[model samples]
Target: MRVQPLIAVEDIERSRRWYQRLFDCVGVHGAGDYEQLMMPGDDTFFLQLHLWEVHGHPNLEPAFVRPGHGVLLWFEVEEFDEAVTRARDMDAWIVQEPHVNARANHLECWLHDPDGYTVVLASPFGDVE
Candidate 1:
């Protein structure tokens, strides 16, 4: 079975551009405010970007409510350091620095995308050592 991530974005266009540059993703399919990104991987991995409005959520007003927060997504990279460096250079919000998570057996880091969704970058221990 394959797993796909459905990410909520405040603005689909802005998020699309950000992810496109960050992950080198190409458009696989899309219509209007919804799109699927073809990430570089052997499996049928896809990143789905959808607007909050599509979910029947009211348009965010400055005083209405704050956007949600938490770990919204995770990604595995072959080169952990290179990926972290690229993300840092792009001014991505570095929520967590890259380090080996001994318990998890992975080298990982965390960053937030334009919409405040946590994006994790990790590499398996086997790949790192």
Candidate 2:
């Protein structure tokens, strides 16, 4: 079985560029209003980004505009420091700076995406100083 998470974004292009700044990957499919991003070494799941309005339903209103209220799109990365640096360079909203989490056994840095989605960047304990 495979699991893919689809996120509704306000602007597809804006969100696409935002994600590209932080990740070194490409969209495997879709265009314009939707795209699926694929991480080279990680195949467990793919992230699908879509516009707030469903395609072919021009008159329909969006069901969810305010995303990530209680959701966290967490990513376990090997390049923890690089990730943090990129996030800062991209001017991403820093929810939490890099800090050790004893309970989680890792160091974490939380950030907000262009659409206000909470993204957690983390590395295993002792992975980086």
Candidate 3:
């Protein structure tokens, strides 16, 4: 049983670059305006970025152009600072600074992808100060 995330986007190329840099992911498969990314880790799931315009999925039309609602995706890391630094270096929009969640036992930072989906950069508790 594997769970994968299918994210609708306006531009596949741009989203590809962002995911590649942020998650160190590589293109596993692609066709036209859609691509599947395989990040370094267990191979149970892959990230799918699809161009909404090409697919003609009505729900994705306006939202892809101006995103709203949804939890989006969360990319967990073992090192919070390194992840945050890489995101910053790429000029990715940081929605929130790193903070500890004592209840959740993690340190996390939030950012919005090109399409405005929230991506969390998190590490287990005590991993970062």
- From the highest lDDT down, the ranking of the candidates is 2, 3, 1
Model 2 earns a TM-score of: 0.84
lDDT of 1 by residue, 35-93 (tens): 78886664464787777656465543332333445445778877777888788778888
> How close to the true structure is residue 55 of candidate 1, measured as C-alpha lDDT?
46
Clashes of each: 0, 0, 0
What tens-digit string does per-residue lDDT give for candidate 2 at 22-127? 8776666658888888886766437888887676555235654467667899888888889899999988999999998877778899999998899999996566
Error of 3 at 22 (Å): 0.7
Query: In order, what lDDT does every prediction score?
Result: 0.73, 0.81, 0.80
lDDT of 3 at 11: 86
Q: How well does candidate 1 match the true structure in TM-score terms?
A: 0.78
Where model 1 places Cα greater than 4 Å from the true spot, the runs are: 40-45, 55-70
Among all windows of ten consecutive residues in candidate 2, which has the lowest summed lDDT?
Answer: 56-65
Q: Which number leads on lDDT? A: 2
- Per-residue lDDT of 47-96 in model 3, one digit per residue for the tens? 88888866577666655345636575877787678888889999999988
